[model samples]
Target: MKKIRAALLGATGAVGQRYINMLDRHPFITLEVLMGGESAGKKYGQAVHWLFPDAIPERFAEAQVRTARPESAEGCDVVFSALPSEVASEIEQDFAKAGFTLVSEASSHRMDPDVPLMIPEINPGHLELLEAQKKARGWKGAIATTPNCTVTGLAIVMTPLLDNFAAEKAIVTTMQALSGAGYPGVPSLAITENVIPYIKNEEEKVAKEAKKILGAVKGGAIVPHELPIGISCNRVPVIDGHTETLYAEFPKAVKPDQVARVLERFSGLPQKLRLPTAPERPIIVRRENDRPQPRLDRMSGSVPGMSVVVGRVRNGIDERSLQLTLLSHNTIRGAAGTAILTAELMQKEGYIG
Candidate 1:
C-alpha cells in the first residue's frame, strides 16, 4: 500500500502533538513534515516539551520543523492543521488554494458556506460539499472543520432523537475543560478551583454549529434547521473533557431505554468507511449513574485516543424533554481526533490521493 504523505501545521502544540502520535502508527498515513511558528527549526524532541513519553516517535527527531510556507508542504497528500485561530485563516487558505487537502481544527472558515463543519457520525454526507468548495474557489483541495468540543457531544445525543422523536428545542449548559483554550491557556490562579462563566464565542458556536451539523443537505448546500438551540458555556478546571448538561424538548414522547439503545447502536458514515481514526461507536452510553466522569471516560478503551464519552441520560415528563451529561476529550475527540477521522474518511472516499 502506498502511504499518504502528510504534514502537520502546528506540530508543537497540544492537539498537533496528538496528530503526530495518531499518524505515527496510521497504516495509511506517512508524516512528511512538522511545521510550527517560532518553534520552527527546533528538534522535535525539544520542540514538544511535554508528551506521553512513549508517544513521541524517534523518527520525528530528524523531521524539519518549519513555519508553514506554501512550497514547504507542496507535495503532501493532506495537511492536518492545528494552527492557532489568530494565524490560521491566511495559512490554511493558502494551503487549500495551493492544492493541498487541509483538514483543520480552527474555527476560521467553519461558517464559510463553502467549508463544511462536519461530524462524521452525524453528518458524513456533508463531505459532498468539498467538491463545490474546490470548484467554487478554483482550488485543488478543500477544508473541513470539527464542531466545538461541547458541540460534538451535544450533536451526538441530539441526532438520533431528532430523527426519531424530532427534537424541537435544545437547552445546553457546558462545563468545558480548561484545555479547550489551548496551550498555556487559562491561568492556574483563575481556574485552580474556579468555574468561570465565560468562554468567548463558545455559546454561539454551540448554537449555530449544532444546527448546521444537523441540517439537511440540499442543492449542494447546507440548509440549517430552525430548531431553537439555547446554549450556556463555562470554563472549568478539568484537564481533559468538557461535560454538558442538556435539556432537549422532543416533539413526541420517547422511552429511556429507546434512547439508550439508539446511542449504543449509533454509527453513521465514519463507521461505515471504517476510517482509521473513526471511533467504532460514535456515542457510548454508560448505564452506571456516574460513569462518564472526566478522568475515567475521557479516553476510554473503546475509542482509545479519540475524544468524547457521554452518560447520565434521563427522560423528562412535563418538560417533554430528555436530560443528560456529556464528556469528551476536548483536544482529542473535539479537535485532533476528529480532524484525523475526517482525513481518513476523505482518503477512503478518494478525496485525497
Candidate 2:
C-alpha cells in the first residue's frame, strides 16, 4: 500500500474528529491537510472540541487548519468529508470538479443517481458508478458517499437477511446516540432525561439510503432494491452507539438460529482483501438474551467499533418474520470508519492512488 495523502473537510466537527482519531498512525493514508470553515487558519487541536478522551495525535495537534476549498487539498490523493448537508453540497461538488476523489459522510450526495451511497461491505460494486459520474457530470473527479449513521447499521444487517432468506420488508426503530446529532448536539436540558422521538429527515434517509445500499449496479447505474423499509428514529441519551430493532418479513419461514448463523458469517469485499479498517466479521451475533447493549457491544469486532453487533434474534409476529436488535458505534462503523474503508477499497481497486 503506497502512502496516500488525504485531506479532511469539516475537520473540527464531531465526525471529522473521528477521522483524525482513526487515521493517526494509519499505515497508508496520512492526514495531510485539515480543511474547515471557522476553524480555518487555526491549529486543529485548538480548534476542535475533541470528543475522544485520548489525546489528539501530536502532528495533527499542531497542523494548521486550511480553508475549505479544492486548492487547500492541492496534493492529496483522496478527500474524506464530514461536512454537514446544508453547506456540504456545493463545497464537496467543488472538490469533485477540481479532480479530487472523495468519500463523504454527508446527506447531500448520497441519493444522487450517479453518486454511490456506499457501505463497502454491502455494495462494493456500486463504486463502478464513479466512472459514469465523471462522464455525466463532466468533472475531472468523482464522489462516493456513506449513508446516515442510523442507516449504516440497519443496512448492513438487512443485506444477509435479504440475500439468504429473501426478506421483502423491514420495519426498524432506532435509538440513536447523542453523538449522531453532531458536536454540541441536543442540549442537555432537552435530552438528558428524555427521548426525542423525532430527528428531522432521519427515518426517510434510513429507508431510502438502505435500499440504495442493498441495491445492485447495472448499466452504469444503481437499480435500487425495491425492498419495503419502514423506519422510526429517536435521539436517545446514549452518547455513541445507535441501537436499532429490526423486524423483517420473509417469503419463507426462517428460524432465528438460521438467521444468526448467516449474520455471523457475513463478510464482504473489504474482509476478503483484508482492508485495514474492515472488521473480521462485519456482523457479530450474540446469543445472550440481554446482549448487544451499546456500552458493551458497540465496539465489538476484530477492528474495534467496525462491526455491527446483533442480538435478541427471535420469531416476530409470525414464523415468516424475524426480529432482532442491532448496534454499531455511530462515529466508527457508521461514520469515519466506513468512509475510510471505502477509500481503502477505492485505492485497492485503482480508483484512487
* Top of the candidates by lDDT: 2
Candidates in order have lDDT scores of 0.81, 0.93
Q: Which residues of candidate 1, in runs, are more than 4 Å off?
A: 53-55, 305-307, 317-319
State the RMSD for candidate 2: 0.8
For TM-score, the strongest prediction is: 2
Write model 1 residue lDDT over 34-62, tens digit each, in one string: 89998887877777765566746888866
Give the range of the ten consecutive residues with the poorest summed lDDT in model 1. Answer: 301-310
Model 2, 96-150: lDDT tens digits are 9999999999999999999998899989889999999999999999999998999
Give per-model TM-scores: 0.95, 0.99
lDDT of 2: 0.93
